[model samples]
Target: MNYTVNQSWKILLPLSHLSPNYLHEHQLFQRQTGKSFLRKIGGGMDKFPISPEILRPTIVFDNEINKVARALGLKGKRMPYETANGTLNVNIHYYFEKYIVLDVVFKQRISFGDISLLQKSRLSSYPEIESLVLAIAGLIVSGNQQSYSPLTSIPTIRCFSIQSLDDNQFSNMELVEALTGHIEPTQRIIDDVLARNSGHQTSGPIITLIDKQGVIQFIPNKPKLTKDALQKYSSCCNLLELMLVIEQSIKDGHLDSNNVFLSALKSLVEKPEDIVKSYTAQRTIKQYSKDFHLESRLSDLTKKIELASSVLISEKKTLRRGWDEFYASNDFFQVLFTALVAGLVTGFGILWAFLKGL
Candidate 1:
């Protein structure tokens, strides 16, 4: 990391012995003639138009990358190399003892053809191509970069489609992946870089994803337990009890039998947050069961009340009809009794009058 910055001329001097024409052409190319020269050589096939504004930033970016390469103990040089398709502007070359890392950056959108050409440019004999890092941005006016699926299969080459080259920025993971080439070491480097950049120490490794927009999104290494799961877990006495319940539910087919969900639950039992979530979910289920039982009871009571009311109404109607029928049958007897009472009263009155005359 403590290497001095060597001049570009000094680096180009060594390449003179290797390829004089390549060295001279590359040196001339770096001095602002590279793009035009490539365009002329391309003969209308490669349409990479460079704006003045972009050209300045690209030069700065190239210089910054050379510094980074030097810091990593690799000799850096800017060169325009020939490819099968046409001439490509290989901006930065990092020379190591065993292999050479070539960096090709484009201000305009890069095509799959460009990538294929770079892959073909690899020399079979001398310094093996260890890594081929291609960085491109701006509008993709032509072929789809996604069609080059074979690039992902190759471990050495890395393709980064960025938003812009203003910051010359790269994700911590990208840097680590390009440098270390191992997962564990790359993760360690990522954590260290993140901790240094943020100025705050982190306990565990940070997982990151780069979006289509070239934005770095950090994903938490640990899984987040849900509130419902926490509630369910609270009802359980301990983790082991929760695990037993889950196991029984799985065996009885009460829970979803999807292996993925079951596997997630099994993994969740180990985490304290997940246990709390489980308790919350259990409590919610219990509440729902109680409410359902109450509803059922109310429904049964209503049905019974309706049946009794119907029976009582039928009985009252029958009693009223019976009384009406009795009145109708006793009508003749009621008239005969009235007539007898009247006749007796008249005879009594006549008898009283004769006694008074005597």
Candidate 2:
């Protein structure tokens, strides 16, 4: 199936590796940027222009670019440079401030035959985009003398695609499964959205969910829509760390165990909504740690995984016992049929003997 997708790369910083004081300073600077720091960075609050040279296939952050970054903090939000294929929008953690996101809006939406292939080529096919991301990261952490290294930050890719449907092409369930790669517990949400939008003459339904790799949103082609109007779907709870562990387990040849763990997790949740809520509620964020104590959170998740494994084993045993009883009943019927047939044959022989004697 072909899809037209809008792609973006989110580069998340390794918060654990950063210094507490450095983070605090950045926070203060961000707060003060509107009042005092704004004046300090440049003449006033205005958009800076990105260098055209950086748009070249091979980007080198020359001394001039470094000088500008040191003074202005790579403050530009728009990419003045454009390619025939698409235009780029670079945001330095504009909303979440946790990472930098490079959004690619194609002049004509880019086409892909397969989602997996598109994901794999996200960085490789666009070398210049990757270089631009690294350059921006370097520029952000350039002048700081803190022990934290920007190199620790790695970029993850996400994409939103639009696939138009023919009249009565597929049912809602089929469409949802096709778009989301069959991520469980999302169908209910999609149904709710579809119900809400029924009878209203508008675009098709949008389905979004978190897959094994990252978030995937399927949107109909609605041009000229504002970003604020966009309906972004996400897991209600922070299952990111849990997902990472599952992915790693698959890499280590624990696929069967992971499957059981996931199945148990789904079974444990009585309602679809519960799937979004965290497994545990006692988690609290610390002052120094940006990830809310990652190690501790992982340990908590580990306990849930163990519990899920046990539940799966119990279910398997129950299934086996049910099958055993079914087979045992069939065996009893077989034995009864054999005894009845032998008795009939003996009676027939005795009757014949009596008639001959008479």
Candidate 3:
């Protein structure tokens, strides 16, 4: 669960491969399982909690504590050597990791005046949000093409965060500097270097964002990554928008529709007051429409709300149907596995006859 090199400057992060379709499939499985006949694998990614302060606990590599330790013959152990241009290529790993430069982050606590259900959910939600956010860094890394993808570009700007335990407690400056040192140059930087040299080989440009929120989401500054606008393990606000985002995420090998759907459900459920609001909105519209405009306007508004609700309900059904087909095919062993065995026998007979003739 935790890997620590030094107790003083240790980092905490979760371990998830963030594979494509995992979250979506999980959502489908959960829904299917809730049904009378079908089985369920688990709930989707949306079941994961959300938080306000996303913390991606990452240690700084530019500080190169390991090299520093070695040079000064310090007793403490630093992980491996991680130089950008060094033979070991530490900078590349940090670049892919999208680690937040720890030099600027500091933590301050706000007291909860009193405890209640709202306070509890709000407070408990943060750590969950923080955990999920860290996964984003890995997700972004997985999305990078130039770093190691056929479908992605080196992220123009990679973002992460470092949390100081307390105010003025940022004693890890050396570590911070060492880690910052290894942050990779971006393509823009490389082009600039090339321009300066008139086409000489040089480093690329790199952008880094550091937030004191303590959230671990490794957001990229590039247009594509920035445009994603997806919540961690949650679906997008718009189904089409979410799908487009998921399509890209899938290409980068982080598809998770299951999580997206679960996120969808979570979002839908969050608005219990919506049901009340819907009635209120309808009444408000009815009251206002009686005095002004034609029947066409009332009809149009009704049609629009009906259309919105229909779309949401239909989308849910469509997701269910897709799962039905998906699970049926994927659960080959759960279905007519005997048919597969019979086909094997039939094919073997044909092959055996051919072999005998030969």
Candidate 4:
């Protein structure tokens, strides 16, 4: 059965450097603003005041920056970036008048097969969606440089929520399978809060699955507070350097499904330790490549693998493994296996001839 998966990615970027005036200069409005409040903290009531002045500025862009502004694809509407297996719609929101929140939706129809395949879909879509986000970041950086001061750094966290495009009453097992691609126990975490507030009951429990990558959550079908929960758990995931690398890859026209970035991501989801080991090995090899005179050979091989468009990325791994096994076989065993395979073919051919004669 084929099911549609709707993966929602929310990138909450804090721009402390941006002000209402700056947003106004860019023809952007304060979508959200802070409010004054009084609260008891450490057994004392404290008051906090915030400016409520709303800024709505008509932006006048110079010729040089106008190109960058246009490149952002923000014309007061959502822009769609197509991926190999899905469509990603992007919209920018200035939240709390301080953060540039990117609301992105990736929709794809996938054939429901093995649970492992579900994980594959989720993993593969990330790089595609990430590339689009990085492209947007690169554009924002350019726009900021020309129109104002450049952004100090890229965001470090990624908040993601995913669900099937159906309203079926999700079973706990189903939720566990979808969230982590494994069948496991899921504990309800929001029952107490739900009991206190009946209004929040329909949103379902925020089930937490502590993964090495981060805290994974099996959210409710409603997805009302999933974003917030994910944000809280995903704060420690730093992707600054990764953002820069992908952004530069996008600029160099290497942001494709077959890129090493996607390969590394898939490997990360399965064997995270292998990724670390591979990185360490690569660093060691690079340090001694000149001494071993292996730099040119490694570079040439890498370029060949990356540039080969004839084979799909999904098959490349299997093909390489096959070749690796074949080359690792003993020379005598290789010849023996080849002869056995030839004998089988010849036997089949002779049998067919005999059968036709009879």
Candidate topping TM-score: 2
Ranking by TM-score: 2, 4, 1, 3
Q: Model 4, range 1-358, lDDT digits (tens) per residue? A: 4444545444545444434333454533332332210110101112112112222212422333334434544332234544556666655544233444454556666555555433533434365455546555444434443345433334422223344434433454544444344444345423322232232122335543322222233444455675654443232111211232333343344434444545543332334344333332223222223222333433444565666754566588889988888778777587878899999999999999999999
Q: Measured by TM-score, how close is model 2 to the native structure?
A: 0.37
Please identify model 3 stretches exceeding 4 Å from their true place. Answer: 1-76, 79-253, 256-358
RMSD list, candidates in order: 33.5, 23.7, 22.1, 24.2
lDDT of 3 by residue, 208-272 (tens): 21111111212223334332222210111111121222223333433233344334323433432
lDDT of 2 by residue, 1-358 (tens): 3344444444433222332223243421232222221122223211211101112111233332333333433333334334445555543322112222233322224444444433432554565555555555554554243322335335553443343322212245543453344443276856753453233212335544333334444555344432311323212012332333333333343433444554433322223222222211111111101132434534445566688889999999999998778668867778678889998999999999999999
* Sort by lDDT, top down from the best: 4, 2, 1, 3
Better of 1 and 2 by TM-score: 2
**Candidate achieving higher lDDT, 3 or 4:** 4
TM-score of each: 0.19, 0.37, 0.18, 0.35
Consecutive 10-residue window with the lowest summed lDDT within model 1: 4-13
- Lowest lDDT 10-residue stretch of candidate 2: 279-288
lDDT of each: 0.30, 0.38, 0.28, 0.41
Clashes of each: 17, 0, 35, 0
